[model samples]
Structures are given as structure tokens and as C-alpha cells.
Target chain A: MESGTARIAVDLLGGDDAPAVVVDGALRAVRADPDLHLLLVGPAEAAGEVIRALDPAQRARVTVRPVRTVVGMADHPVAARADSTVRGAVHAVRDGAADALVSAGSTGATVTAVALGLGRWPDVRRPALIATLPAVAGPVVLLDVGGSLEPRPATLARHAALGTAYAAVAHAVAAPRVGLLSVGTEAGKGDRARRLADPILAATSLPCDGRYVGLVEGYDVSLGARADVVVTDGFTGNVLLKAIEGAYAMAGGPPTGGGAPRAAALLGVAGTVVVCHGAARPEDVAAGIGLAAHLWRRRATDQVRALLDGTEAGDREERTDRTTDTEVPTS
Target chain B: MESGTARIAVDLLGGDDAPAVVVDGALRAVRADPDLHLLLVGPAEAAGEVIRALDPAQRARVTVRPVRTVVGMADHPVAARADSTVRGAVHAVRDGAADALVSAGSTGATVTAVALGLGRWPDVRRPALIATLPAVAGPVVLLDVGGSLEPRPATLARHAALGTAYAAVAHAVAAPRVGLLSVGTEAGKGDRARRLADPILAATSLPCDGRYVGLVEGYDVSLGARADVVVTDGFTGNVLLKAIEGAYAMAGGPPTGGGAPRAAALLGVAGTVVVCHGAARPEDVAAGIGLAAHLWRRRATDQVRALLDGTEAGDREERTDRTTDTEVPTS
Candidate 1:
């Protein structure tokens, strides 16, 4: 949708229902965005199927980089012997053939490939996967959707900073209020990890004039009346996102605005990379491609990095003590 | 709703909108269920409000147990100087004054009071809070919603068995498929707690002919296409239930099946107890009373406990390994 030509590397052999859905998704993305170009990374036959569907003008905007489908799950040891399409797509982004990359592959595999290929941001040890959901207040930014399953307290502090900046840089929210996700909004409410991480987030300085709101409950993630950016560990965030999606389905449809996002931006990576849900439909894959283009055009990565450059970790605990009201009202 | 008379002791000082909402709920419940009787445990003035609202015919079904409204939250230890309405309700059940009890008080306080007053089931160190969500497949039972914020791997395995039994006894779910909730369906996916709990759940012998379906994602909780009963730590389950409630709100309302249950059954306690959400409205409070009456009529607690008595802890590991098919495919 942006003005500049955004070239995205699409992993044609990424998802559980690969090639067919991927080919269909690539075609949809190409036809929707006039300034978008795609570098298809998968088997030539799969890429050819997509190319054959497009008209002459649209076909000229797409290119193919052939690679066989190879999964690299932790359970699959022999899977390492084969070259992966996810890695091949990463190479395309690294080689400057694409402005950004999008994949509906295994999240762990994509994170591993991107970290090894394009490199990670200097400060973030556990890069976060940030997803923006449409909420009543606006877009609510949630992070670490499967980036690091078991993040330490310090890692969570870093993610608080990352989420704060992402809300401003990516979504253009002014003075976004950031909150730590927990069982309850009340002070001293959650498990061990949350109890330790709460104070750290409270004292930590945020980018783009973002305010650190106190603890927020799970409700805030969907109905974003309390916080604009919600920071949580990957395990909780990942499951929460999926649970909301399921709830929407059970409710017959999503709200008029939209549903929880299937595409997430890989924050702390050097390049603009988007990961679609593994079980994503064709439309979800297209949305992932569109997200990659939007991020590439916005230069969100560099801007967020710049914002976090000078801010120190929360060491000023005295000023940030729980003397004030902390709970975001349940109702 | 059942044929037998169900006496439920209601805590008048329980919820955020206590007294007013409790009075309204008690009136509605008595009017709705002809076979239901209620013992109001709170201030004399609050009980009088409910009695004044009821007609002469309905007034005979209600009894007043006058106790001043006193709370025992962490915020107010001095508040404990007064008698707790929740404890009075618990004692009423213990003394055979009531068939079951319903409270919208602090979950920890209610659990503590019940465990001490009514006693707990053998070997259940941490009691589980079981909530039945209406999903497309049927009622998907979720447990440990706020009973034990941090549970050991053995505790989760125990809950898996408990949930399986409750599904059969309470919901009439035959041969419930129990699944340990995690980030993904894959064997190795999730946080440290889930990684440790996965195999334990698999090896565990479930009650009511229930089978362990391995790791289930958040989608299975709402959609119910994968598992009949989902087991998780109290912290995760607590937040997850709330998130689903918020999502349903965002989706305009719940599906035709029903919404998330505001009340959860407290298993492992030697009584039919239901705890409503703290933000329970008048309708939710009435629903809690209804759930307690339902549980009492079914003799659910005694039946579930009897079912779980013979099942040994999951010490037999060889028969249930990762080599077996774990993922329950979602359509």
C-alpha cells in the first residue's frame, strides 16, 4: 500500500499446506499491491504455478528462486541434511533481492534462520515476535508470540522496551501506554516470573514518550482500553493469541474491526521479517506479505533501534515502588 | 433444574458489586428454581433486602444467616477483624445446613476456607478450579483456572486425571480425551513447565475411560475440535479464560452454544462449591448458584473423587512415549 516498490521474499514451501496455499497467497499479494514485487523461494514448479496465474505485467514483477521443501523441526534430525526454503528466502533478503521476507513456516525455524542469516539487534538476546491485534481503543501491540518460550526476567525487561518502541514506530501511536501481562491487574498478582518482572518494567524508561502502565490482565490484550502495548513471555503470548483467534471462530465471526492477527513482525531482527501462522489460510499469507511491505516502507526496525539506544534498564526501583494505584480495573 | 431439592449457601459479601447484586441474584435464583433453597450469609440488612424483594411463596425457600460483611483480602488484614461471610457459608455446608455453597469472593480465600473447613481429597496438594466452556464439539472442560498459580509437573498430571473425571461426572462427557495445554501440539514445544509436564500427562492413567491426547494448543480450549478436557497450570488457565471472555466481548457476544462460564467448580474439596468471577454481574451470580445446585444434584465431587481413587500416578512411562501419535488434528 506504500508508494515505494517493496520486494518481499515468499517461502512457497513453508506451511503445513505448502505450495498450493503459498502459490495462491503470492498471486493474491501480487494482484493487490501495484508496487509490490515477490521473489518466490521454493520448487520451480510451485513458483511456476503462481507465475502462470498472473498476467504479463504482474508476472514481470515476480521472480523465482528454486529450492525443495525441507522442514527443520527439533524432532527431525535428518531434516538438517536438506536445504530449507525458509533459509533460502532469508538468503534472498540478505542478498538484497528482496526488501523484506515473509514466511508461514515453523516459527522456531524462521527465528533461527533469520537470526543466523541477517543477524540480530545488538541489545536483544531473545528477539520478540510482535503481533498487533485490532482492539476497541485501536491496535494493541503484543510481543514475544513464540520468540523465546522461557524468557528470563531481564529478557522480559528488554521486551518491555522493545514493545514500547514497536507501538510507536510501527503503529504510530503517540505516547503508547505499555503494560506487563499477568493473571490479574492487581499488584503482587501473578506467578513467580511475573512478580519479578513487574518492578523492572515499572522503572524502565520507554521510547517515543511511552508510559509504563502497571500490570494489565488478559482482557487488555483484546479490549485495549487500558494499555496500547502489552509485554509477555513467548509461551503465554503465543497461546493467548491463538486462543483469541479460536474464541472469535467460536463466536461465529470476528468483531466489525477485524480479528486477532495471523501475521507477526519479527522484532530485534536486523531486517523486516514477518511470520504468518503455520496453519494460516491463503488470505493470512497475503496479509503477512502486506505486513512485510508496510514494515519495509516504514523503516520501523531502524527507528525502534534508535529509540532504545540510550535508555538504560530499570535500576531506579525506589521511584517506581508500588505506592500508587496499580490495578487496571477489571470491568 | 433437577428433581431433588438443592440447598445452596450464598455469600452476600463476595463480589465487587456485593450486597446489591447478591441480593438481586438470590431473588432471581429462588424465583427460577422451585426446588432450590438458599441460606444468605452476610449482614442482616443485606439479607433483609433479598427477603423484601421476594414474594410470600418464595420467602419460604430462603433462610437468613446474619453475619456482618467482612473481607479477608491481602490489602486489608485488619478487615479480618470482622467475621467473613465466605467462612460462614463454608461452615453452613460443613454443618449440613446447605447442600452446596456459592461465593464470588477472593478465590484464594475461598479455597483456603473450603480446604480447611470441608477438607481436601487425599493427595491433591493443590485443588483445581474447573470451568466448562461451551464449544462447538460440546463442553470443553478446563481445570486449574486459579487453584494453584504454580503447580509441579505431577500436579498438572493429577489435574489431567481430575479434569477427565469431572467431565464424565458433571458434564456426562464419555471417555473424555484429556490434553495438557501448551504452546503447540508438537511433543517438544512449550515452556520449561510444559516440557516437564507433557510426558507425565501422557503416562498418567485417566479416570472414566479417559485418554491422554498429548500437548494441545489454545485453539483446542474454545473450538473443542481436538480435546474434551484441557489441563493447565492455574496461572495460565486463569488468564486464558479471561482472554477468551474478552475476545467474546470483542466478537459482539458468545455463539449460540453459550459464553464462558462465569463460575468454576472447585475440585479436590469435599463439598460442591462454585466460585464466580469477582466482577460477576447479577446474572453471573445467579449462574453460580445454578452451577452449585447442578453440581450438588449430580453428586459430582464425590463421584469424581471415587473415579480418581484407583488411578495410580503416571509411573509407567514405557507404554506412553513420544513415538506415539500425539497431535489431535484440528479441522
Candidate 2:
């Protein structure tokens, strides 16, 4: 909806029901946004179908990069050697063929491809998959939904900064309140990781006028009254997000505002990237593409990286803490 | 309702809105269950009102244990104290003056009081709080909902057995399918604790003909198609329950079956105990009391303990490669 041209690369063979659903979603995205251009990256046949389906004027906005699956290699028993389409999409962004990328593929493969191709931000050991839930008060940003299963306490503190900056840059939430998701709101109300991270978060400096709000419960993620940003380990975050989605389904439908998102934005990489749920429908893929464009137009990745740079340097100046062996990603 | 005299000790000075809500809930329970007897624990004046309202026939079923507030003590502040009415209610069960006990106080305080007064089952370091939610397929039992915030991998494995037995004895779930809660259903999909527990659960033998069905995602908790009982650390369980409750509220109301439960049954203690949410309403309090009476009448706690005993001994006899340091409570 932003008044700017945004170019995004579409991974045609990335999802469980790829090619067909991806094509349908790309068409929907192209028709919805007048200023949007797409660079479809996949097999020539799949890309041709999308290009031919568009009218003359609409066709002008679309381009294709031919990628052929290696025959005989497909039957090879190795997962790593397969000609993955997600890798092709990552190469498109890395090679400057597209401003951003969207994928509905295996999260591990997409993350691996992006981290390898686009390069991660310096000092971000584990790039997070952030999802924004449309809560009652405003958008509640949750992170590490499926990025790294296990992160150290220092990594969690670093994520707090990333989440804070993302809320300000992408969602425009002023003076965002950041909270660590735990069992209870009390000081010592969680597991050992949370107990260690609580004090670390309190000591760490946050960017974008964000302040740490000790601890919050899972209800805060859906209601958004307690904090604008909720940070947790990827494991808990992933399950919690899906659980909220299921809760909405059981309740008949989501709140009038919206429900848990089926897509998430990958942060800490050099380029803009959005990942949809593996079981996403056509509409979800379209939404992911739109999100990729929005992030690219806002220059969200660069802004968030800049914010993190300032905070990390400030943290270094404060003290020479034991930074070694702390699995805090230094891209 | 179970065709026997069931006396329940109700903690009057528990919960955010104590005495008033507790009184109202007790009145409802007495009216609904003709064979139910109530031992109201709180100030004499609060009990006097309830006694005055009941007819002579109903009055016979009600008794009171007066716990006057100290002169300088803050009003309602007594509700949060560990030695208040909830503690007295626990003692009533210990003295055989009541068949079971119910409280809607601070979870930590209630847990500590019951463990000290009624004594813990030998070998059990932390008790677990179990709640059953009515999902689409059937009742889904979730455990450790605030009992042990940080459980070791062995503790989680122990809970798997407890939950499996509980589903069979309490809910009469036939050969219940147990699952370890995680971010994804695949192996190596969760944080360190979950990753470690997955293999242990897979190797361990479950009681009551139960089977370990591997890892389950959050949606399965609400859908109940994948597993009958879900196991997680206390922190995730507590927050997830509250989040589901909040989601149901945002959805206008709960589904036709019911909403997330306000009351959870306490396991690993030597007595039958049920805990309601701190913000429990009168209806929630009544439900907590009802759950306690039902558990006591069915001898669910005793039966579950027996089943666990047989399983533990069997596990020892097998002496498999997997070894766990988990402590099992001995009655």
C-alpha cells in the first residue's frame, strides 16, 4: 500500500503444494499492488505459466529467471545435494536481481540459504523469525518462532534489541515496551534460561527508545496490552504461535481484529526476506509476498541493523564482559 | 452426585475477590449437589452469613473453621499469606475432617502449603498441576501448569508417565496417547530440554497401556487428534492455559464444548487438592470444589499413584539403556 515501487523474488517450487499455489499467489500479489514487480525464480515452465496468464500491461511488470531441476540428481538420496528452489531464490536476492524475497518452503532450508547468501548482520549469531500478531491494543511482535531452537542468554538479550528496533522501524511503535516471555510476571517466575536472561535484559541497553519490561505471560502476546514486543526462545515461540492459532479456531474464529499470522519476516540478514507457513494457502503466500514488498519499501532491514549497531557498540563500551563462547551471532 | 458423603474444605481467604466469591460459590455447590458438605475456612462473620441463609436441612451440611485476621493485618492481605485460610483448608484434609480441598489463592503459596502440610509423595521434588481442556476430538490433559517452573529432562519424562496414568484414571481415556510438547512434530525440533526429553519419553514405558506418540505441536493441544495428553514444563503450560483463556474471551466466548479451565488438579502430593485461578469467579470456584470431590470419590489420586508404582518397578526390572534421575513420589 505504500506509494513506492517494490520488486520481490518469488520461489516457485518452495512450498508443500508449490508451483500451482505459488503461481496463484504471485498473480494475486501482482494484481493487488500496482507499483509491485515480481521476478519469478524457478523452472521455466512454471514461470512461463505466470507470465502468459497476465495481460499485456500486467505482463510488462513480470520477469523470470529460468532454473531447471537436475534430472537423476532428483533421485539421489542426499538432501543437501538436491537442486533446491529456495537456494535459487536466495541467489536472486544476493545477485541484486530482486530487492526482496518470499518463500513458503522448509524453514530450515530457507534460513540456511538466506544466511549463506545474503550474509547475516554482524554480532547476530542466530537470526530470528519474527511474526507480528494483531492484538487488541496494537501489533505484538514475537520473535524466534522457528529460527534457532536453542540460544544462549546473551543471544536472547541481543534478540531483545532486534525485536525493539523491528517494532519501531516496521510497525512504527514508539518507545516500544519489550518483555521476556515467561511462565509468570514475577522476577524469578521461569526456567533457568529465563532467570539468567531476566537480569541480562535488565542490564542491556535497547535501541529506539525501547525499555525492558521485566517479564510477561503468554496472554500478553495475543492481547498486546502488556508489551509491544515479546521475546522468547525459538522453541517456545514457535509452539506458542501455533497454539494461539489453534485457540482461535476452537473459539469459532479469531477476534474481530485478526488472528495469528501464517507468515513471518526473517531478520538479521542483509536483505529483506519473508517466510510463510509450510502449509500456507494461496492467500497466505500472497500475504507473504506483500509483506516482503512492505519491508523492502520501508528499508526496515537497514534501519534495524543500524539501530542494533549503535546498541552493540554501546554495550561493548559499558564493559568488557565475557563475550567469548557466548553463541551471540556475530555475522 | 457419586452417591456418597463428600466433604470439601473451601478456602474463603483465597483468590483476588475472596470470601465474597468463595461464599457465593459454596452456596451454589451446596444447592447443586445434595450430598455435598462444605467446611468453610475464614472469619466467623463471613461464615455466619452463609449459615443464616441456609435452611435447617441445608445447614446440617455446612460447617465453619473461623480464622480471624490479625488486628494490624491488612484487609484481604491475609488472603495472600501462606498461613491463611488456604493452609487451614489443607490441614482439614490432612486431619480427615474433609474428603478434599479447593483453593483459588496464589499458586506458589498454595503449592508450598499443601506440600508441607499433607507431605509430598516420596521421591517427588516438585508436584505438578494438571488441567484438562475439551478439544474437538476429546479432553486434552496438560500437565506441570505452574508446579515446577524449571524441570530437568528426567522430570519431564516422569511427568509423561504421570500424565499417561492420569488420563486413564481421571478421564477414562482408553490407552491414552502421550506427547511431549514442542515447536515441531519432527525430531530435533525443540529447545534443549525438549530435545533431551523426546528420546527419553520414546524409550520409557507408559502405564495403563498408554503409548508415547512422539513430539506434538501446539495446535494438537487444542485439536486433541494427535495425542490425548500433552506434557511440557510448568512455565509453558501455565502461560499457554491463560493465553487460551484470553483468546476465548477475545473470540466473544468459548466454543460450545467449554472454555479453558480455571481449576487444575494438583498431583504428587499425598492428598486430593484442586487449585483455581487467582482471578477465579464464583462459578470457577464452585467448579474447583466439584473437581476435588470428584477426584476424591473416584480415588483417582490413589489409582494414578498405584499405576505409576507398577510402571516404575517394571522399568527398573527391564533396566534398559535409558536412565533417568527423576524422583517418583511414594505415598
Candidate 3:
């Protein structure tokens, strides 16, 4: 529905059922959005299949990079796989051939490639993978899905700021209420990491009129009755998302708002990038492409970066003023 | 449907909605099972209310244990609250007056009181809270829902054996497959704790013909397509269970297999204890009482302890034989 010439690079050999699924997803995306363009980055045969499947009018909107290599799911992220299709897609985005990139491959490989190609935002030690779930109230944005598996308290506080900014920019949420995910909503109810992160998140300032609503339970993640943005370590976030998906499957299907998304946008990177599930279906891959195009059109990555920078600067200034206030004159 | 009389001590002053909800739950539980007997452990007025509601046949099945103190949800577990209703319920089990105890109170308080009163099993340093979810295949047993929030690698390994025994003894899951919960199913796909616990679980000797599956994702927790017994830290398990419950609510209702349970059994303690969610409704409280009665009738606690002890002894003997085989002849 967005109106803009947003060019997206799709990794043709990424998911478990690659090439075929990617081709189908690419075709679906091209037909859904009139202002969308795709730069297929994979084997020539796969790319040609996509072009041949499209109509003459839609053929003009598709292009190909023709890379063959791929990063396997078990491969190391920083290993010598520079010529992989995902990496090639990242290069296409960096070179301005595409405004954003989408891959249903290894999450680690995609995160590494995007961070290396586009660079990370200032003051961000680790990039965050943000997934938005449609809840009863509205969209609930969860961050650090698999970006940093074991983040410290400071990293969680930093992610709180990123998630807040993303909820406001990507979802058009006003005055987002952010909450820390824990076992219970009580103040002192969690493991050591949560106990440490709770006070830190409470003290940290959030952008876009965002405020910390203190500790929230797992129910808050799906119900969205408590907070708009939920922040946690990547390990917990990743498993929690999958469990919700499985629960929806057990319950026959998802709600009217839709189930947990299979595609998540990688924040803290310098460019708009969306990563789909490794076992994604054609529709999931198409959703990933749509998310990439939407993020590119809205310039969400750059806007979040700018907001984070202002917040960090304000935090530093406040600390400096506090330090000065605590100082006593020796004279 | 269990024929034997199950004497269950009910905590009268527990949960967010106290005496009123407890009174309602007690009446429901007494009427549901004819062989069930109750020892109300709280104010005498609450016990009188429950007795007055029942007919003459059921009136003889109920008794009263006068206790004035109640543990607040935010109160510290071990700090001078020994006379609380949960503690009194534990004492009722310890004194042979009750076969099992159920409380819709603070999980920490219940765990602490039961551990201290009944004493833990020989090799279990931390008690485990186990919850069974009805899945497509059968019941999926998940342990450490709130007990031992931040367990060590050795604790997780010990819990794997405990979970295997529980699945077999409590749920009658023959040859249950145990799995360590992680971000992904790959060998090295998890946080540092999971990476350490994976190999430990693989090497652990299980009881009741249980086998260890390498690793399982969060989906396995609900779907039960991979493993029958899923082991995780209390923190992750607690949140995951609540999230699934919320997802079921979002989906309008649970499947025919049922939803996430609001009541969990506390294992590793010598006596049977069931802890209900702090926000439990009347039916949930009734379910907790029902679970206590079921566990007591089946003697699940004693059976699980015996199985765990055999496994631990076998593990020790295996290590001794290996040590003996590696010894060099100095002569």
C-alpha cells in the first residue's frame, strides 16, 4: 500500500526450500506492490525462472545479480563466505542498487552481513532483531530476538531505547510504553539478570515520548495489555516467539490481528534489512520482502539511528550534570 | 475418578483474590470428588463457610486447622513467615494428617515452605516445579517452571533425570524422550548456559527407559513433535508457559488437547505439593486441588524419588567403573 520506488534485494538461495520458494515469493511481492522493485541475488537459473513467470509489464521491475554461493545454516557467520548470496544482497543494498535486503537464510549470516556491509549505529555494541506481534490492543514490538544471545544489563537498556524508537517509527505508535520481560510483574521477581536490568531500564530515558512501565510478565507479550514495547535478551526472545507460534498452531489458527510474524526487521544496522525464518514458506518470504520495502520507504533505519544518537547524547549530558552537582569545592 | 481418599490441605488465604476464591474452590473440589477430604488451613471463618455450604455427607469430609498469618506475594520466603498458611499446609502433609497440599499463593513461599518442611530428595539441591500440558501426542512434562530460576549446568542435568522420571511415573509416558530447551535444535545453537547443558544432558543416564534428545526448540514445548519431556530454566519456563496461555486466549480457546495448565506440581520434595498461579480463578484452584489429589493417589512423589535415586546410583557406579578401568598398575 505504500507509494514509493523501494528497490529490495532478495536472496534466492536462502531458506530450506530456496529458489522455488524465493521465486514464488518474489512473484507475489511484485504483483502486490506497484512501486516495488527486486534485485534477485542468486543463480542465473533461479533468477531467470522468476523473470519468465512475471508478465511483460512486471518484468521491467525485476533485475538479477546472479550470485551462486550461499551461507549454510550451520556455517559460521564470520567464516570465509564473502561471495554468498546474502552477502551479495547486502552489497547490492550498500551500492544503491537496492534500498533494502531480505533473506530467509541463516539469521546469523544475515545479521553479520548487514552489520559488516552497512555498519552499526553509534553507541550500539550489538545490533537487535526486532519482531512485531499483533496483539489485542495493537502491535507489540519485541527486540533482541537472536541478535545478542547473552546481553548484559547495559545492552538490555540500550535495546529498550532501540525498541521504543522502532515502535514509534515503524508502527506509528505514540508515546509507547516499554516494559522489561520477566517471570513476574512484581519489582523483585526474576533471575539475577532481570533483577539487575530492571532498575537500569527504569533509569534510562527512551525516545519518542516512550516511558518505562517497569516489569511485565510473559502474558504482556501476547495480550499487549501492559506495554507496547517489550525488551529481553535474545535467547529468551527467540524461544518465546517460537512458543507463541506453536501455541497458535495448537489453537487451530491465529487471531484476527494475525499470529507471530515469521519475518523480523534487524535494527541497529545502518540500512533497512528484514530476515525471515529459515523454514519460511512462500508467503512468509513474501511478507519479509514486503517488510523490507516498507522499511525502505519509511527510512526507518536511518530515523531510528538518529533518535538513538540523540538519546545517547542526552544521557551523557545528564550524567555530566549529575557529576558536577555531586562535586564539592576543595577551596 | 481415583478411588482412594485423598486428604488435601487447602490454603485458605492465598492468591490475589483470597478467602472468597479459596472458599469457592474448596466447595467445588469437595463436590467433584466423593473420596476427597479437605483440611482448610487458614482462618476458622473461611473453613466454617466451606463446611456450611456442603451437605451432611460432605461436611464430615472437611476439617479445620486454625492459622492466622498469611504470606504476602511480595514477602520474602524465608524471613520470619514460618506460621503462614502455606507453611501450615506443608506441616499438615508432614504430620500425616494430609496426603497432599495445594496453595494458590506465592510460588516462592510455597516452594520454600515445602522444601524446608518435607525436606528435598537426596541428590536434588534445588526442587523442580513440573507442569504437564496436553499436546497432540500426549502429555508434555515441563520442569522448573518457577523453582530454581537460575540453575547451573549440573542442576539442569539433574533436572533432566528428574523430568524423565516424572514423565514416566506421573504421566505414564513410556520411554519418554527428554530434551534441553534452547534457541534452536542445532548442536551449538544456544546461549552459553544451553551450550554447556546440552552435552551434559546427552551424557546423563535417565530412568524409566527415557532417552535424551540432543536439543529442542520452543515449538517442541507446545507441539510435542520432538520430545515428551522438555527441560528448561525456571525463568524461561515460567515466561513460556504464560505466553502460551496468553496465545490460547488470543486464539479464542485452546485445542481439544487443552491449554497451558495454571497448576504445577512441585517435585524433589519428599511430600506432594501443588502450586497454583497467583492469579488463579476458582476453576484453576479446583484444578490445583485436583492435581494434588491425583498426585497423592498415584504416589507420584515417592515413585519419582525412587526412580531418580536409582538413576543417580547407576551414574555413580558407571563413573567408578570408568575410573577403575583407567587406573595404572604401579606394581
Candidate 4:
């Protein structure tokens, strides 16, 4: 939808109904975005089905990277084979064949492949998966959705910066308010991880003029009245996101704006990567591809990285708590 | 509603809009259940208002335990004041004046007072707060909603048993299936606590012919198809409950069966105690009182304890792996 053309690498064997859903999603994506070009990564036969479906003019926007199954390897490990497709998709982004990548594969496989292929950002130990939920007030950015499960207090503090920066750059929010997710909004309301992270978030400087809003309850993730960005350990964040989606389904539908997002932007990694739910449908995969394209055109990653740099500099000058010493992993 | 008379102690000065909402709630509870009696705990003026509003026959069903405040105690801590109505309500249950107690007060205050006055059940460490959400399949019992904040792996396993027993005794579900709430249903899917608790739950013995069903995702809590009772730490459970409630509210109203429960039953304690949301309205408080009466009539607390005893005895005889040594703390 943006002015500039964005090329995205689509993983055809990523979702539960891989290849079929992925091909269908790719067709939808290409049809929706006139300025979008996709480099399909999968078996040649599946790629051929996508190419044959498009007319001459639309077909010109598509490309394929043919993959095949080697004979005499019928009993190969599933993990090894799954890792190949994700690695190929990551390599496409690294080779300048695509501006970004979209996958609905196992989050661990994608995260590992992406982090290894495209190095992590400086000062970020664990890459964060960020999901934006449509709240009543505005968008609520939730970080560590599934990238890293057991984040230390320092990793959480670092994610606070990442989330604040992402909220401003991706969502175009001015002076975003960040909050640490916990059971209650009161001080000392949550478990050990949250109690320790509270003071650290309060003391740490946030990017984009973002301010830490103490502890926020789960309702704030959907309602967004208290904070624009909610930070938590990946385990809690991932389950909470899915739980909200389920709650919406049980309630008949989502609120006025939208429901819980199926696609999440992988931050803390250098490249533009969008990870959809593993059980995502064709429409969800298409939406993930569209999100990746949008982020690439908006230069969201660059802007967020720059914001974090400024925040890091300010923090260094203001506080003398900077140290390489590791603290206990409370999460 | 049941055949037996159930007298419930209602905490008058417990919620944000105490006395006013509590009085209205008590009136609704009395009207709904012909055999229900209420022991209203608060000031004489507040009790007098409820007494004056009811008909002569209905007024005879209401009794008051007036809690007089000191004339010059403006600096008294409202939560710590020994003469607070929640403590009085707890005392009423301990003195055999009431079959159960219901409060929409501060959760911490209620938990502490109830544990101290009524005493905790043997072999139960931290009592769990259990909330039953009306899901598509049936009622899903979620435990440790707010009773204990950060529980160890053993505590989580114990809560699983507590939830399983609760689902059977309170909801009358046969062979209740229990699941540990986690990010994914895979074997090694969650953070440290869940990773450690998953195997323990799978091995632990469940009551009422209950069985442990490995890890369950967030959707399982709302759908109830995967497990009858979902177990998690109090923090996650608390937030999840509120988020579901908020989702139902945003959807205009709850589904046909009703919305996320505003009340939760307290387990691990000897007495039957029901806690409503602190921000509950008059009708929510009334529903919570009604729930307390219903559970009392069913003798849910005693039945759940007996179920636990049966399971523990069976475990000891089977010589299963009891090396986990996780004890549910009775506060």
C-alpha cells in the first residue's frame, strides 16, 4: 500500500496446512498489493501452481526458488527438514532477493534461523516478538510474544526499550506509554520477575520520549486505557495473546476495531521478519506478508533501532548502573 | 435453590461501593433463594437500611453483626483495621453462624482473614482461588486466580489436583481432565515453572477418576474442550480471568450461556468463601452471594477435600514417584 515497491520472501511450507495455505495466501497477497513482489520458497510444483493462477501482468511480479526432496532420505528427521525451509527463507532475505520474509513456521525454528542468519541488534540478548492488539484507546504493543521464553530482568529491561521504540516507529504513536504486564497495577503485584522488572523499567530510559507507566493489568492489553505498550516474559505474553483471541471467539466476535493479531513482528533481529501463528489460515498468512511489506516500506526497523540508540546514550549519561554482570533469571 | 437452608455471611464494607451495593446484593440473594439466610456484617445504620427495605417475613431472615468504628480513628488503616467487616464475616463462619462467606473486598485482606480465622485444610499450603468460566463445551475451572502469586512447580502440581477435585465436586463433572496452562501443548513448551510442572502433573494422581491431560494452550481455558480444569499460577490466572471479562464486555455482552464469572470460589481453606471482583456492581455481588449459597448447599468444600484425601491415599498405596515433595502451603 505504501509508495515504494516491497519484495517479501514467503515460506510455502510453514503453516499447519503448508504449501496449500501458503500458496493461496501468496496469491491473495500479490492480488491485494500492487507494489508487492513475492519470492516463493518451496517445491517447484507448488510454486508452479501460484504462477499459473496469475494473469500475464500479475504473473510478472512473482519469482520462485525451487526446492526438492532428496531420494533415499524417506526417514529423515522432521526437525532437520523443517529447519531447511526456514533457513532458505532467511537466506533469501540475506541475499538481497527479498526486502523481508514472512513465515508461519514453528517460532523456535524461525527465531533460531533468523537470529543466526541475520545477527541480533546490539545490546539485545533475546529477540522479541511484538504483536499489536487493537484496543479501545488505540494499538497496544505487546512484546516477547514467543521469541524468548525465560527472559532475565536485564533482558526484560532491554525489551522495554525495544517495545517502546517499536510502538512509536511502527504505529506512529507520539510519546508512547509503556507498561510492564502483571497481575495487578499496584507495586509488588506480580511474581518475582515482574517485581524486579518494575523498578528497572522505572529507572531505565525509554526511546521516542516513551515513559514507563508502572504495572498494568491484563485488561489493559485489550482495552489500552493504561498503556500503549505492554512488556512481559515471552511465556506469559504468548499465552496471553492467544487467550485474548480465544476470549474474543467465545464472546461471538472482537471489539469494534479488531481481534487479537495472528501475525507478530520479530524485533531485536536485524532483518524484517513477520511470524504468523503456526495454525494460521490462508488469510492470516496473507496478512503476515502484507505486514512485512508495510514494515519494510515504512522503514520501521531502522527507525526503531535509531530510537533505541538515542535511549541507550541517554541512559548511559544519566545512570551509572550499566554493567556487564548478569543477574539471576527470575522468569 | 437447593432443598437445604444455606446461611451466608455477607461482607458489607468490603468493595469499592460497599454497604450500598452489598445491601442491594443481599436483598437480591434473599429473594432468589427462598431457603437462603444472610448474616450482614457492617455498621448498624447500613444493616438497618436493608432491614427496613425488606418485608416483615424477609426481614426475619436477615441478621446483623454491627462493627462499630472508633469516633476519632480517622488515621486508621482501612485494610489493616481488625474490626473490618471481612474479618467479622470470617468470624461468623468460624463461629458456625454462617454456612459460607462472600466478599468483593480487597483480595489480599479477604484471603488473609479467612486463612487466619477459619484455618486452612491440612496438607494445603497456599489456598487457591478458583473461577469457573462458562465455556462452549461446559464450565472450565481455572485455579490459583489470586490466592498465591508466585508458586513453585510443586505448588502448580498441587493446584492441578485442587482444580481437578474442584471441577468434580463443585460442578459435578465425572472424570475431570486437568491441564497445566502453558504457551504450547508440546512436551517442552513453556518457561521454567511450566516446564518443571508439566511432567509432575502428568505423573500426579487426580481425584474423582480425574486424569492429567498434559499441557494446554490459552484457548483451552475458554473452550473447555481440551480440559475440564486448567491450572496455572495465581498471577496468570488472575489476569486471564479479567481479560476474558473485559473481552465479553467489549462484545456488547457475554455469549448465550453468560459472561466470564465475576466471582471465584476459595479452595484449600476449611470454609466456603466466594470472592467477587473489587469493582463489581450490585448485581455481581448478588450473584457472588448466590454462588456461595449454592456451593454451601452442595457441601462443595468438604467434598473436594475428601476427593483429595482419596487421591493422596491411592497415590501412597501405588508407591508412585513422590520425590517432587511439593506441598501446597496453607496460609
Report the number of the highest-TM-score candidate: 3
Pick the DockQ winner: 3
The segments of candidate 1 whose C-alpha lies over 4 angstroms from its true place after superposition are A72-82, A313-331, B72-82, B313-331
Alpha-carbon shift of residue A30 in model 3 (angstroms): 0.9
Candidate 2 CAPRI classification by DockQ: acceptable
lDDT of 1 by residue, B1-331 (tens): 5878999999999988898888888988998999999999999899999988889988999998988765744443234334689889989999999999999888877888888789998778799999999999899999889889899999998898889989999899999999888888878888899999988787788888999988898999989989999999888888789889999999999888888888999998899999998889899999999999999999988888887776853333433543343554345
Model 3 Cα lDDT, one tens digit per residue, A125-236: 8889999998999999998889899999989999999999999999999999999999888899999999999998988889999999999988999999999999999999
Per-residue lDDT over A1-331 for candidate 1, one digit per residue giving the tens place of the 0 to 100 score: 5778999999988887897888989999999999999999999999999989999988999999999866744434234235889889889999999989999888888888888889998788899999999899899999889888889888898888888888988888999999888877778888899999998787777878888888888889989989999989898898889889999999999898889899999988889999998888999999999999998898888888888885653334433454333543333
TM-scores of chain B, in order: 0.92, 0.92, 0.96, 0.92
Which ranking of candidates, highest DockQ first? 3, 1, 2, 4
State which candidate, 1 or 4, has the greater DockQ: 1
How far does residue B246 in candidate 4 sit from its true spot (Å)? 1.6
lDDT of 4 at A312: 81
Give the worst 10-residue stretch by lDDT in candidate 4 chain A: A69-78
Residues A255-295, candidate 2, lDDT per residue (tens digit)? 88778888899998889999988778888889999999999
lDDT of 2 by residue, B11-76 (tens): 887778887888888888888888899999889888877788788899999999987532111233
Tens digits of lDDT, candidate 4, B165-267: 8888788889998999988777777888888888878878888888988989888888887999999988889888877776776667788787778899999
